[model samples]
Target chain A: MAHFEKASSITEWLDQRLAITTVKKVMALEYWIPKNINFLWAMGMVLAFTFALLTISGIFLLMYYQPNVDTAFDSVNYTIMSEVGFGWLWRHIHGVAASVVFLIIYIHMFTGIYYGSYKKGREMIWLSGMLLFVVFSAEAFSGYMLPWGQMSYWAGMVITNLFEGFSPDIAGGIMNAPGLVEWIRGDYVPGQAFLSRFFMLHVLLLPLVIIGLIGLHFAALRIPHVNNQDGEEFDYHEAAKLYKEGKTKESKVIPFQPVFLSKDVFVLGVYLIFFFYLVFYHFNFAMDPVNFDPADGLKTPAHIYPEWYFLWSYEILRPFPKDPGLIAFGFAQVAFFLLPFLDKSDTVAPANRRGLFKYWFWIMIVDMIVLTVMGKLPPQGIWNHIGLVAAVVFIALFVSLPWVTKNENRA
Target chain B: MKNELKILGVVVIFTAILYWGVEPFAHTQMHKHVDGEHFAYSDLNESTKKGNVENGKTLVMGAGACTGCHGIQAVAHKAPMDAATAVSAYGVNPPDLSTAGGLYSEKFLANLIENPAHALKVEHKFDAAKGKMHPMPAFYGAGGDKAQEIADMVAFLKSIAPKEISPKNAYLDACGRCHANRYGKLDQLGETPTFKSETDTLKHKVAVLEYQDKLKAYMGKLPPDLSIIIRARSEHFLETFVENPQSQLEGTSMPRVGLSAEGFEKVKAYLTQTGDPSKTAREAIGPWVLLFTLVFTVLAYLWKKSMWKDH
Candidate 1:
């Protein structure tokens, strides 16, 4: 939070001109982070690294990837896999990184919630992150559609058709475009226009939004020092005081560089090794095999599941009818933003936080995992009931947070 | 959050050890039963011992199971009864062998003729009628000149009726046995194929489903259409694997019909035509992929170290 240190002449000059010192103090090497916050704090750094990797790999893939319905699958199979040198490597990295990045983000989000980083001062962080999650999901769905494979085709059909509830044709055709779904798709079914639009959204439009949001998210995070596990030193006044004074020996918080940067870089190295293992050794682990076949609207696969990261939500999507399910899904994320407000727990540290919150928190985690597993199975027979129950419990965990906080005793 | 960095470091070390540990195990486990002594196509001397197609046509017409279940060229007094009535008497319903030559590899056919259950990897479960477990009896040594006769049979199948003779050939060569070929245009069964779309493949599925009696006659255990089988089994395993059931999978009832080494080659040629014909190309491309990955890993490691040094 140090704006100026009266150190270097170049820095001083830049500060006089454009307040580079202020910028540096806010987010750069001069930014101060809590020294006690360990590797758990590095989750954001890890996510940023993976996002950069995904973006780079995705750019390389975009160079050769054809977003035409006719050539999409073949372009991936022949041009990308065989014709272009190391194109397969880049494609694998992009696809695997896309799935892996969600995993890292979920863990990162969990860490945010586990500590009370999302509470009060950091509510904007949670809201922006949730918005980013929705945008990224849209990006993923669009990217998936660009492939024009079987799952991609059906997924495009199923998700796009959710908009049918709002379409004039579904109602009584009172006003606008009678076939809005067909108009958006540009055909009776998913075809060239769908691929083109999805490609544009996946590569161009959504990334800009994500980049903008990330800037704001990081900026917001900088204002509030990271919450530690045992959470004690939470003082906005102290942060302002430290910002006024360049150096503080008494405060335990350290600068971003040297202390945190080394640990972040080290964790990133380990993460990359696992990344390569998935890309090289388990290339098809995250993908559905039916994607190899080209799209045929006449035929559908026996089971159609979204990527695993979306499984928990997809599980929630089951058991209810489409219209309400869509609304439920929308409300679910909207409810997520209210979590910080719902959690009326006193202490910032989960360790000292009294009540049934810790137990409830664990139940939600296990519930999500259970729902994820159930999503992969067919939504029939016993699974219908399981999904219904899990979905109820999932919503209950978040919705009843305020009530749970009121009723529960101190831990 | 406390001692978590040390925990992460320890996890990384263990992961690295585990990562390095898995390569050799993967290499060994990739093809677990790669028996060295097994016969390959290279072992057979096909030049001097060319399979006589003429002799094969004769054996196929007159052989015990050949004439009984299979009708190759012509003259088959339809088995006194279809498989259903016969299964009651013999506990097995044999499949039509019109496309047998194209469906099975020469080695597979030879092994099957010599030792049916062993070749097909099944057991002689006498109680089960018209079941997969019912034994297929050995046919190679049944006659006076059984060995040579089997070779000729295999040659006839391989050369004359390949699973897919060419992209232009009719798709019927393999599937025509169990499934009927019902094209609206007659005499087009032998005509050149020009499939610009999946409609051609879809037509095959419809034609196969048209034979309700054929499917029902096998009782509950319908032999899966051979159209997809070639894609499932490989050549080398099908070669050394044809003669003995115990060498590979045990407990299944496909009887042996012995064929000589030359006959085995013919069958291998026939079945492999449909299944994994691009195997050589896939194998050729594999090494380059491995090399690229290994080289990039080293480069990534060096770059990672350099990036972290400043941090």
Candidate 2:
């Protein structure tokens, strides 16, 4: 142990024991941020805000939500929406946050890729962020099942069936895909067992995991610091020292507090305006119309599609025959995590400064949008061909990344 | 700054394309728009346009005999039988007609008065395949063939109806007997009755179940609750389907309840209220919330500028 100073006040007393002053210094006040970053850097804070909103609203919803199959639909549609005061407001906030968080995640993700934030020493940041993304996806999927509605039932059915891809022939016996599905569902179909388990995962297990992963995600950021738009590397310690010495204009970095937080607050204010607009007036996109119908095992809806966030991968899985589609989907899910290794370019700069990488980035984005659009459409006629082409392009783009970036030089 | 503009431009273009593909383009591909003209009851519309309300009232009270099973609450025209007796006889309670004028289309009412089976589009139930007759008989006893008399009856119902009926009242009067509004706290028989005793509650429960069973048998399936129907269906589809059930779903058990355009609007409002009750408050508070955020953003921008002024 080191020598301790005598405490003078409550904060001082607490700091003597808990290192409160050190924590505040390390986490916020003395934390250095690149001054060259733009509004996109604020997305991380926005996502944290959204997660807080989701957790709070989810707790409120859990108070009224019944997990039993017989009563779950009515509990959500009637009891929560009609009976509970401000229940609809909580629901709207939860719903819009759930959806809009994904939009921000995608933007945050692409921003990282464009700025080469996942390269060199920043791999852990990318890896931890991807882990958080996966956990968030699981949280969203499990929460979706709580409604016990037509879309909920069918989407659950379709997604769980993906486990079937694991079953393979072995020694004159077929592995039971159906049996695995039954074990996961706790029945042959989605019912009381499915509902209860998903409810537990959504409310308790997954949320705890998400909170833990979020901490890790931020922790991973501390070591590498944040990447700048220009991808210009400099000594952060020297820049921070210069900022401290009142040479703020000469310094390339600024303290995270006051300076960085001001810009973040401005971005958050803008983001909230967009978010509340959706929450209040245009929430239909977040809550599917077909989901209003109670779950029926026998009656399948005319069209079934996952939420928009998952559409790009869903489209990738759609056009190909089962096994091939499954393989492609598996690839798409893990592809982003492999970005650090796949982009062979030595330079760490914005895509605009990289020759072929710029085109690659833009094409990847357009291809993803195309896949998402095709995913929602009925896979027939012209749409089938378009989806097939888009899916092919998606896989081809990932496969070509290494070759495209290998010979590229910083512009 | 140039890079920010470039990013913004890209984002705007990308979002616009995505919206077009998802909303308008996807919609056209998924649902084929049904033409309302195909289901329009032209002759009935013409007759109702020139109906005599006084003559309609006399016919309903005397010869039309609508008062035999149905009650017009606004005029104190009670049904001849009690609800229990009516349920046993017709397998469903006859809805009150106090708001029928505001709840149903004139054409639908005129057609229903003339031929319940034909107007409701449940002709399949009475055909040789099913070998069953509708509980409500055709109005053959009094000017049933005369379209003018049927139109007059509709006009009378309309005349007696309250000018400004609530959405809940409109839904209960028009559809409550056959369909439940579960989210709105209504059973198949409108409001769930509160009984003073456990036995009375038990009796009500049994009656409701029995009524639902009878309805299932009569129509091949119990009607779905209308709590979320507004969200589940598009306005055009609902309008066309209400006008004539067979036009959208061939051989659907649902009758063409023929709501006049105004009645459909009220029913839709009720459904929307139940399905998305927070819509009103959400929309009302949206502008203020946006304004507050805008002001905060401006203030934040100014603070950011001031903080960076030294740098």
* Cα lDDT of model 2 by residue, B75-162, tens digit: 9878777666777788777878888887676667777887787777777866534767787877764635477777778889889989
Candidate 2 residues lying further than 4 Å off, grouped into runs, are: A1-5, A166-178, A409-411, B35-40, B43-45, B48-58, B83-93, B124-135, B140-148, B162-164
Cα error, candidate 1, residue B281 (Å)? 14
Query: Residue B127 in model 1: shift from native, Å?
Result: 24
DockQ of 2: 0.73
Tens-digit per-residue lDDT, A49-112, candidate 1: 8789889989888889988888887677556765677776777778888887787777778777
Tens digits of per-residue lDDT for model 2 on A360-386?
999998998999899999999999999
Chain A TM per candidate, in order of listing:
0.88, 0.96
Model 1 residue A89 distance off true place after TM-score fit, in angstroms? 0.7
* Deviation (Å) of B194 in candidate 1: 16
Clashing pairs in 2: B104-B260, B105-B259, B105-B260
Error of 2 at A144 (Å): 0.6
Model 1 misplaced stretches (Cα beyond 4 Å):
A1-26, A166-180, A234-250, A321-324, A407-411, B5-148, B151-311
